[model samples]
Target: MSAAEELEAGGAPTNFDAMVKDMVRLALSSEYARVPIRRADISNKVLGERGSKQFKVVFEQAQRELKRRFGMEMVELPAREKLTITQRRAAQKTEKPSTSSKSWVLSTTLPQAYRIPSILSPAKAPSSKAESTYTALYSFAIAVISLNGGSLAEQKLERYLARMNVDTQTPLGKTDKFLQRVCKEGYLVRTREVDGGEEIIEYTVGPRGKVEVGSGSVAGLVREVYGFGQEIGDSDLEDDGEGGIRPTQVEQSVKKDFEMRLRRTLGMQPLRDRRAADANGVDAGAGAGADENEGRRRSSRRPAAQSESDESD
Candidate 1:
């Protein structure tokens, strides 16, 4: 344990300045994948793939990495057992659905396992360098948005570059390029916002983006990444973690989440270069939005068709 961390843990200054420095460390770490240590019926004697002590060591190491990289204070591992029926019922009763927000019965089914076959398989390191690029960009982008509240615009990119101590005008076209790729991937769809009568592209996450948890299992991945993908930083609102999640962790998690969602929504395709189409035909302007709307309409109309199809079958 570093002396600084020990001091902070031992009730030293718990201010944002001290915390922000730690957050930057996490943002800069190259090997900091936020996978959780699952504590189920594997055995009390073993923690990770090793014995209890070794497992504890590995857990602690991962925790330390999480702290050092993302300013996350060590949290107690999750309880192993499933919730009792009564406990679940009570919890369900207390949970009120968000009535003010719009609702849609979007299909929750996953894509066919064959398309992005690797994500569903047993853990294996990605074979190619390109496979990990989205993850890194996701991490960095999260750090930018979470720690620094800004839209994913060119100005935001410049601000992020400055924070990283890189030249503001550096030719880092990859980030923008990735954004374009995401739009093409169907994980994101862009809208034309009229500003002074000039249409500017604004991007939003899609359903596939909702499932983007990288190689990490879906369990707890949203909490680890976006602090709960639905909301940005509400985990800190509760004191469940003795004091709940720190603001820094919440920020990092949300930002990471947005990136993952962006990747998932966009898919593994190379970003499209459609800036030229900004001046082109209405066909170019219609884009995936029309296709998506048609898809949703078709999907909604399919249950009857499916029943008939089943009857025919």
Candidate 2:
């Protein structure tokens, strides 16, 4: 049946299908821009003025359509900012703020096996030079802020950026404007506070930032930043069972400093694991040598005993 026929067959909502299509489109636009999609935008742009109450149904349909067609789904973002001390105390006497920001960011729904580099690598993704620069800058910024207890002083941030030759200007604009654009796009949150008469500015990951380039993603990238050198480790060698050894070093990233520090603090296990097979091989060799020596001694004693027996006879 045609859409008109379907509508005539008692589809109560007048523009439900159109709303769903619009919803998907708007969501894709927001995702491509690397910004969070808000419910208000959906109510106004996609669902029309009267359709504000149809958020749940429209959202469900849009999510299903996105997953089916694009292998992506919208994830509800957490609160964009933490509650201040005063706000927290005020909330104790009244209704608390919502855990969700009533916004969403699109994320992949594809299985891990299907997300290889050739299929979805950064090189393959469509991006302009400005977008690429913005992504790298924000990703590094977020990673730094997260690693540094989820906050970094503005001065320190600038220093770090300066070290990377980002002090004066960037693809976006001057360094300050570049940082402002990142904050404006919701990739990072910048706040000012006064402590002991010192006005300090700090940067933290924002809702869109956390959802898109989360800590896990940052860590994955960092691990590949400076991979292990050509130096072989115990893990490289494997006995072929027939006596030959095989070298297996699947290329992988290794931040030796972080790894060693973490390992030493936690379990103290060396990065290169000692092979039990090699130790067992040494033990077996010693046992075989001992057996040969025993056999020689036994043969010598037997000759003497045989000679003595013959003499007695």
Could you tell me every candidate's TM-score relative to the true structure? Answer: 0.26, 0.66
Give the root-mean-square deviation of each candidate in angstroms: 25.1, 21.4
Write candidate 2's Cα lDDT for 15-63 as tens digits: 7778888889998888766667898788789878777877887788788
Give candidate 1's whole-model lDDT: 0.34
* Residue 245 C-alpha lDDT in model 1: 54
Evaluated against the true structure, the overall lDDT of model 2 is 0.59
RMSD of 1: 25.1
Off by over 4 Å in 1: 1-126, 139-154, 157-173, 198-200, 213-313
The sequence of per-residue lDDT tens digits that candidate 1 reaches over residues 1-313 is 5434564476454332243333334323311232222244222323333343343333444445544543333322112121234445665676663322111112212222221324322223433333344444443443343333222554555466456544333233444565565554333344554567865543434322322321112212333554343323233444576745555666656655564554344331111312233345323223432122221121110121111111110
* Per-model lDDT: 0.34, 0.59
Candidate 2, 271: how far from true, in Å? 14
> Could you tell me the lDDT of residue 122 within candidate 1?
20
In candidate 2, what residue range of length 10 has the lowest lDDT sum?
299-308
